[model samples]
Target: MRKVVKYLIVLVVFFMIPICILAHPGRLDANGCHTCRTNCAQYGLQDGQYHCHNGNSSSSSNSSSSNNSYNNVTTRKTTTTRKTTTTTKKQVYGCMDSSAINYNVDATNKDGSCQYEKTETKTEDINYDTKIKGNLKEGNKTVIEEGQKGQKEVTIKSVVDEDGNEISSEVVSEKIIKDPVDEVVEYEEEMSDSEALTILIIYVLNIILVMFYSKKNKNSKLIINYVRRIKIRIIKYIIYIIYFVYVIPVFIDVILVIIDFVKRKLKK
Candidate 1:
């Protein structure tokens, strides 16, 4: 019991010294801060009896460091959410032969109807073999290229819609070609049977007229012989010669015409 009482007195004295020094800040002594047994504040020995000061090396400096650690973690969670966003850039290109011709198009909207389209196809594949090199300098700015080695995306979209309810039509095509175009040719020709028979009938009538010119005076009776004998037998010979040569072909042509007409009428 005596040892415990002695230990309790020592602890009481140690705690009371700090309270006394805080309440009444005295000058530093040669021995620095101390905790003595004499209660000098309650007596008349208060001038140099309770002189105590903090040592130069003490734990008071770390007491104020706790103020720097307060955070806004709760308010940050309520105000906003953290998420990762990805941004992308796209470019589209088209290509075709420059000398295209007669190309039909039926697009829905916003397109070239019948134009020859071409484009330059270029893509960047990083030349990693060249070796990009850099250095870190003091008191300087540094910027990082985000995605220098990644590939780019390209997209092209096309749509075609036609109205099925509209009536069918013959749309006249009119297109002006810029490049040298090939020549076009058109011909219209038709022959009918009536025109062909008119030609045949003219030749036949000419043949009948020539055949009736016998160039001799005939008897007035219905059937007469060669009565007026020829003083110009050569003329008569020429006349009859022309008649026989031309008349035979005409008779045969007339017979063919009659047969063709009969066949056509029977078919009808």
Candidate 2:
């Protein structure tokens, strides 16, 4: 019984495992599919943050001749400034779940960290389990067998990670079967009609004798005789009933006898 409960637990774990994986908030999906997905204002895929700026620039010019042709004096001034900055970032996602449990270690990130979001969907198909209920004739195996004996057909599925740890499970279908029990039969030797009548008459006489003797005599010897007669009559009645009602029709006992007879003949 304890073992049966364990199998059910394993099966249930298989089915429910997918749900558990889906239920949790997935690993942070900061890394969007940026290749085709053009870079947004806040972030860019191909090129990271880029900035360029110029502070300010000014110029002035004036001139005066040595011969004093021009009365006013001239002056010149010039200024230049500039600013620039750049940044790059990458992400990866897909087969190898960074956050998921370890199962397969062979997967890799194709190009740098190509950030990806996990979108899981369930797949339905057959799974192998040896535990099944039924008459394990030779090769047959069973999962649960205590409540009743039978050939129970069951459909079970479980969800697990790459490794075979039980996560969640469900029953696709089930059938309860009852094993047929052979009735225990007692066989007695058949008797002739004369033998039957003889016992019947003896039973009646014993009853009468016991009652009448008890009424007349308080003697121990007579009581013992009455009991002995009753024992004999009971043994005969049992033989008649067992032979007619049980042993003959059941056939198992008769088969055993036939087999023994065949064995004897073969030896001869």
Candidate 3:
């Protein structure tokens, strides 16, 4: 009976050996190979060792070719998946117009938040100032120096639309191109008619006194000669006044009339 029991145990051990070899927990790859997970030394393999089954030459070649094909397919699938993921990435949106102040070069789409800048130049006239020199007669004007206008250049910066229409503007810089020249005026002073008449009356009274003194001292020869010289001087002054005030104007008018008549006769 012991021999019979020993024989049954031997048979069970022999069948269990093939079962353990085929029942490795590691999964097979495309090459029909698997890494050893347990009982490696028993199978003549190390831990984490890759091994394949023994087969015919033709089958082994076919399996290797299939394994290479499977690897190529898997590589192609991984490349396509990466390409798809990149294509599906989130898009960035920003201003796309180059003229915009906040333009974004790396943006994928326009967000309609573009801001533009425009500059304009303008010229302005500066008014000249006037300076009065002296007290002049009423309604009389004499210009001593002519006045000139100045020019100013203004640079304006503005925010505008795409059509170049201005939305808002600000003065950026101002420069004076030319300075203004001030005007200078002078006036003349003159005497009144009433003062001239008083002077004439005083001169007449002085002449009468000189005449009375000459008659009172008829035997005084020196006094009479001095009075006669004074009278002659007064007459010469009156003649000079008449020549300047009345005679010169009338002479000028007569000469102008004669010249005009001569010109008309020549034309005829």
Candidate 4:
């Protein structure tokens, strides 16, 4: 009976070893854990549940690692979306011309609101007035002072197109750079000594001739009366010519000289 019992125990041990080896069909992970796909109740676990023979199980670790991976992927996606949004932002619009008054430095597009300005120098000729200083011969003139033109600076504000073509402009300010100078002229009308002497000699010759003619013709009353009448007519003609030519011109010159003197006094 003892021999038969020993042989039966050995056969039972061999059968139990194969049954324990084939109990779990899935392979183990690095943590010696696997999912219970079949015969879960035999190992005290639910179907598709993760378990481990070691004390530390991979269930919580794997869940946390998956959560972290998900968070990292979500963060990367969010960062990528932000970068794309920043890169595709709308462009700013304003005046892009550097010479404009309303130029914008941060603008990417031109909206035509630019206002431009420029400084222009302009010269205007101020006509010089002539001032007569003294009396002159009827057809003679002499310059005493020269005349000059004036200059001014003008600041202008303008509205222009993108191509620098002016659309509208207005004068902002003006300043005179140079003042005009007036022209001064002088004239004189004076008779020479030689001319006066010549007139005196002619008068003396005429008087002597009249006296001689009167004395020679005195014997006859009618002849003396006729000679006296001719002498008077000739004297009157000479006096009239002298008065008309010399006296009238001298009188006019004196009047002009008085007028110029009066004007100068008033200005002073």
Candidate number with the higher TM-score (1 or 2)? 1
Residue-wise C-alpha lDDT for candidate 1, range 110-195, written one tens digit per residue: 33323332322233343222222243222223323322343332232222222222222232332322222222222223223685
Ranking by TM-score: 3, 4, 1, 2
lDDT of candidate 4 at residue 187, scale 0 to 100: 71
Q: TM-score winner between 1 and 4, please give it.
A: 4
lDDT of 1: 0.41
* TM-score comparison, 1 vs 3, better candidate: 3
Q: How far is candidate 1 from the true structure (C-alpha RMSD, Å)?
A: 29.9
In model 3, the runs with Cα more than 4 Å from the true position are: 22-94, 105-113, 134-146, 168-175, 185-268
Clashing pairs in model 1, backbone N/Cα/C closer than 3 A: none
- Which is the leading candidate under lDDT? 3
Candidate 2, position 171, lDDT: 70
Score every model by TM-score.
0.20, 0.19, 0.38, 0.28
Cα-based lDDT for every prediction: 0.41, 0.42, 0.64, 0.62
lDDT of 2 by residue, 1-268 (tens): 9999999999999989976643322132232111112232222111221111111111233221222221221222223476666665445433465654342345645322223223333433333233333333332223332232345555666555544455666777665443433322223344444654565556556556655765677664564455557757877576556534533443444454455545555868
Please write out the lDDT profile of model 3 over residues 14-132, one tens digit for every residue: 98997765455768666666656787555444565555543312221122222321232111001123444445767999988887888998888988778798888999999999888
Model 2 misplaced regions, further than 4 Å: 1-148, 175-268
Better by TM-score, candidate 4 or 2: 4
lDDT for each residue of candidate 4 in 1-268, tens digit (9 for 90 to 100): 9999999999999889966764666786787666668875555455666655444434243321122112211000011234444467579999998877889999999897787765565655556677788656543567889877677777777777666788788888888878878888877554444654555456556556655664676454564355557757877576556534634554555456555545555868
What would the TM-score be for candidate 3 when compared with the true structure? 0.38
Better of 1 and 2 by lDDT: 2
Worst 10 residues of 2 by lDDT: 49-58
Score residue 2 of candidate 2 by CA lDDT. Answer: 98
